[model samples]
Target: MSGALAVIGLGPGSPQTLTPEAAAALDRADALYGYGPYLDRVPAKSGQTRHASDNREEGSRAAAALRHAAQGAKVAMVSGGDPGVFAMAAAVCEQIDRGDAAWRSLDVSVVPGVTAMLAVAARVGAPLGHDFCAISLSDNLKPWGVVERRLDAAAGAGFVIALYNPISRARPWQLGKAFERLRQHLPASTPVVFGRAVGRPDEKIGIYSLDAVDPSAADMATLIIIGSPLTRVIERPGRSPLVYTPRFVEGGH
Candidate 1:
């Protein structure tokens, strides 16, 4: 009797944003495994066990969760935002691909939740209304050159870019470098949004032009959206400005 493994997304950072399906999956889990901060998001259950690890231990954490599930104990691997979006789902799948046959045999499911970019986009209108692509600025897993190339290609092709894992203490300069790269392809007046800890108490969403935007304003918790030339900003009398990209582009279908 193989047990199940559920990769659950806890949404951005708000309990109110957690999906019903994710809540039920968490309820059914006999054990949970995830990064310390993300594991802290899920309320504790009476008999359920939690195994918390460092944020960088995705591979080992996935393996441990799979091993637990293979022993007939229902396990949930938790992630912040949507599990499939540069999160635990890919880690779990990678482990399964190279892991034991029993690990592969375990029943697995991924429960979706609101990812950071979507949450940020909703808070400030839809910059994602047009064609968009997400790229992680972190070079931990891949080469920095790959990130640079993707940024160039995405910007050159006029795709609105959503940057994840933008900056940290160790890699403080990359976001600035990214801004520089974008400036080569985009207008100085292009809209850029820095959404930090969105949906949480300390949430901060700042709208800036590409030339005036400061990379130091963002951290690992921030999700930055770089709008295309067609993106517009609408002002209201007493409300925050709305930022959106028109669905229809000029001259092409």
Candidate 2:
């Protein structure tokens, strides 16, 4: 076992998209760590242990994995979607900042994975087709005041919003704050799409507006796509409803 903690992004749950380097790293891993369901995705390896936990325990879980690596274990800290995008990378860095010599002793590298924002954006014909910013509506690590500031900035700047952790069990009203901020910049007709359990069998994608979105409709599995000022709903003759950002279109009134 080598003294290294590898944070691997397991792409949007497809073996075909797994890069060769990630695959090889998994082969060398003595242990794997990540969200409970996501940890099940990796094929079982000989002598490898799997450490699984809920999403919000990222810091504690990651610190444990770092300890494993410190004690001469080749550990893989897994993140669904991308490791760096709304994933475990930040938690790992935070643990390192505490000056834990065990954390410092281990080599750490982030491996990229597919984020839900990119996946959902492509599914909706490019909601984030232009400059955009992402903000998680969860206040676990941040205060609502800070989240509100960012939400206001994104809306005022007309940047498409890739909202992560929009709503969860414990914190429901944070999303209301997010929508309230958006309303300051966008009109009631602005298109908003709610993508629940994306890329899975029971996946759902629905379009709504700032006023129309139901807060209870969102959960840990859901990812929301709020359109920019330039976004419009293109209802084609026979195709599915499309929510798109017309950022590149010229000569607008």
lDDT of 2 at 93: 91
Candidates' lDDT values, in order?
0.96, 0.83
Residue 211 CA displacement from its true place in model 2, Å: 3.3
Can you write out model 1's per-residue Cα lDDT over 98-131, one digit (the tens) per residue?
Answer: 9887777789999999999999999999999999
Native-to-model Cα distance after best TM-score fit, residue 103 in candidate 2, in Å? 3.1
Residue lDDT tens for model 2, 49-164: 89889877988998898888888988899888888987888889989988586577678998887788877777778788777888888777788888888888888888888899
Q: What's model 1's overall lDDT?
A: 0.96
For residue 115, model 2's alpha carbon misses the true position, in angstroms, by: 0.5
Candidate 2 has its poorest 10 consecutive residues by lDDT at: 244-253
Candidate 1 clashes between residue pairs 3 or more apart in a chain or in different chains: none
**Can you give the TM-score per candidate against the true fold?**
0.99, 0.91
> Where in model 1 is the C-alpha error above 4 Å?
none
Error of 2 at 36 (Å): 1.3
